[model samples]
Target: MPDGDRYPLAHRLYPYARSADQDRDAGGPAHHPVIVVGGGPVGLALALDLGLRGTPTLVLDDAEGIGEGSRALCFSKRTLEIADRLGCGAPMVEKGVKWQVGKVFHDTDLLYEFDLLPEAGHKAPAFVNLPQPDAERFLVERIRTAISDGAPIEIRGRNRVTALETSQPARLQVETPDGPYALTADYVVACDGARSPVRKMLDLDFEGRVFEDNFLIADVRMKAEFPTERWFWFAPHFKSGDSALLHKQPDDVWRIDFQLGWDIDRKAELSEDRVRARVDAMLGEGVDYDLVWTSIYTFQCRRMRKFRHGPVLFAGDAAHQVSPFGARGANSGIQDADNLGWKLDLVVRGAAPDSLLDTYAEEREAAADENILASTRSTDFITPKSKASRMFRDATLALAARHPFARAMVNSGRLSMPSIYDSYLSMPDALPDGPPATRPGAPCPDAPLGDGFLLEKLGSKFTLLAIGCAAPETGLAVVACEPTPELTARYLGAAPSALYLIRPDQHVAARWPMADAATVAAAHSHACGATT
Candidate 1:
């Protein structure tokens, strides 16, 4: 067993000094332009995004620091790109275990191994495995740096919201260490997680299905030569009738999940002996491993019907939640922040109307639905509902070993990927013969540019990516990228020249082979919810 003292899991506390005292003396609630609740990955990310865009944000968290254990280990490429834009991607990638290969198994047999990224010329990989705590810490550091540089972002820890008033300008009654105080904001974002207090206070119902089976998640530190790849077993030898997942994290920590049946005694299952017995069975009896943390959770694939409730908005776990079969939880939440940040910034700056925020709900709700569907399918496949379902699942796995066609049907958690927004915000492609890879509503494909990737050249503002031709003069940021063979193949199929109007979030809003300034401006206006 590893020494617990040597590898201590310490919570870094952010000291809370009373800032509401002055407001109390002034006999009114302190006002902020934007107030974000729950300082988790999504909330922090949203604050960072708004801060970077020169929007003053105040973040309130009940907890002092990041959560314990290696939760949400798999960070997807799309999420990494979002983090990169937020100025914290490099550290996460550097600290994470980068891998793309995942192996699915039936009993002792290796059914199939799949590579998520077969061909890669992009800046970020298919996925990286960094513990949630580390990612949160990196974000916190980024926020602190921004705070130092006058970004107008303040994080007050141990400041919990006890009551919420969702008026035009939301009012929140916060309970701090000092005392209870009233606070108000022009806008309130609830990122308080699955058991969101904000959601509860508003009496919002999270409507969805909850799976019967429970999963035992245990983080174990051990010295082993296991390759940094995702290993999944369906009815494995160690756990004879259940599924098991083994994933590697930094610092030699491994996250193991055992799908315990519906009727398991939750407390007994999480006991040290029971947990150790399971780990020993999987890793062999003599393996030296230290139990870091263990928890039992039931899967619930659910979300609120509407992410936006009046002046208050919901992001991350507060808005939607899914079974952790796929890494959709944090990945989707980061995208939520990415989607909301720019839109909210526009509304804050009076560049767009408040109705622009509705577009955020529209686009993100579509994305959430996509994620929910994928996660639900994976959960159902993993934990079959009926005998027939189990039989079919087993047959599929059996055929997957030999039949190439069957491999495509296998669903061992279709890993998280960026969802293409197919809503009204995405303008239809004007060019009939444009490349589908750079189609409107799709994410902007990254390619090699001068010393950096093409995505690096695009600014946070609306950009016109002129490929293989001179960019037309426009008020928006424009970048003329020389079309190399790879670039041409990805962004400019048969066409020699194209103009892509990319959104602030790096999603292509419109594309045209040739367009005058009027057309480009109209597309931009349409993207910002203006009917031109």
Candidate 2:
């Protein structure tokens, strides 16, 4: 985090090279099975997933490298898990600052504190604060390794999508330093972000609310004694009467967010002198620090009504938008990629019906709704538009400081949690099962195994996990193991034994107390969207 050059990964990682993809436009569009339109985290994760599934993929990115700064620093556990499955989690975890505790304050007084990860046995931590640019770089590096190992993935830098034809085998007009080229794909995933050119070309728009408030971000590199915890303040005594947040990132960088109500002088607020004055007040007189990055942001809670349009699909910010308060933006976008990847792969391979892709749109649409609702509430509570609302919020904060019950009502930010889908693919739960945590629709919880973790065992395949039971010949690969205490507690608290049908994305599709070939076959068929 040098002040001179900022983040090391900020320099171009991908070099632009001229390709003959342009000549394909003369005859017709060069056809691919799947194409991703952005090189950001979501796009890269999705491409990596598809390639790992043996689906040939090509990523057309406008830029040669990731964006600068610690743009989005909070990567959720779910995001890390997804990255692990994509073979890039180790580097991401190594380069991140992990924290699970958070504190909320009203002025100088502590209201209440919360722990994000209360228990052990999970593989990924609650959150890892790594710069987004570093994350992208790591994912790209992993993709390079996978390509070397023969994973049918190609990323072309400086290839920008200028136009799109959303018909079946969606066509794209791409511009590069060399010239313009055209290509087509059976499906085009738009991870081009909130200002998505793909969405605009397809004439799509987001629907929801935009917050009027602005928050200034000052990412400063310093040697601070502050603990690795998220500290948020409301009506701080420090000069400004607005809310603020302090979070530590990797490489001794700190992210400070100062809420600057509705009206703000963008120029003055961003000035070196003004930013330094604010930092001085927060850190007290003379803390030597170098400003690495600074920017102002106003957030919105919005999503497209439909994520799928004919042959084109949307993920990440292209599909939905939310305020940064809850850490939902990039986290949910990566989850979107997670959900869409396997389904698209199965569809492309002709192993599942094209309608299976509909579940991606539906389930992730539901998740976007969940995130939007939470983010909207956090924004409203943080910046009350009405006098009455502000007074009520203040009173609630005051009460939360003393009473424990009121703590639930105080919303600084809800934080990101994986969506337990009411998915059409989800099977109904049987009574008498203990692990609602591993319910049919929920993301599988990682538990310790003999040598590795349960998630690592699940890998990126449809797996049958039979615990304390004999493996049945269900035509699906099975991992039959004795029930460990953790597995027994999570899978069969009251029951004797359990068998779980896991999806390629590691989400539980179905579970039963005992294994039978007929039953397992039926469940597997249903989960895979097999035609009867």
User: Clash pairs of candidate 2?
Assistant: none
TM-score of 2: 0.98
lDDT of 1 at 529: 86
Question: What is candidate 2's CA lDDT for residue 7?
Answer: 77
**Regions of model 2 farther than 4 Å from truth:** 1-3
Residue 214, model 1: Cα distance from true site in angstroms: 0.8
Residue 87's lDDT in candidate 1: 89
Could you give candidate 1's per-residue lDDT for residues 172-228 as a string of tens digits? Answer: 999987778888888999999999999999999788898999988888888999998
Best by lDDT: 2
Lowest summed lDDT window (length 10), candidate 2? 1-10
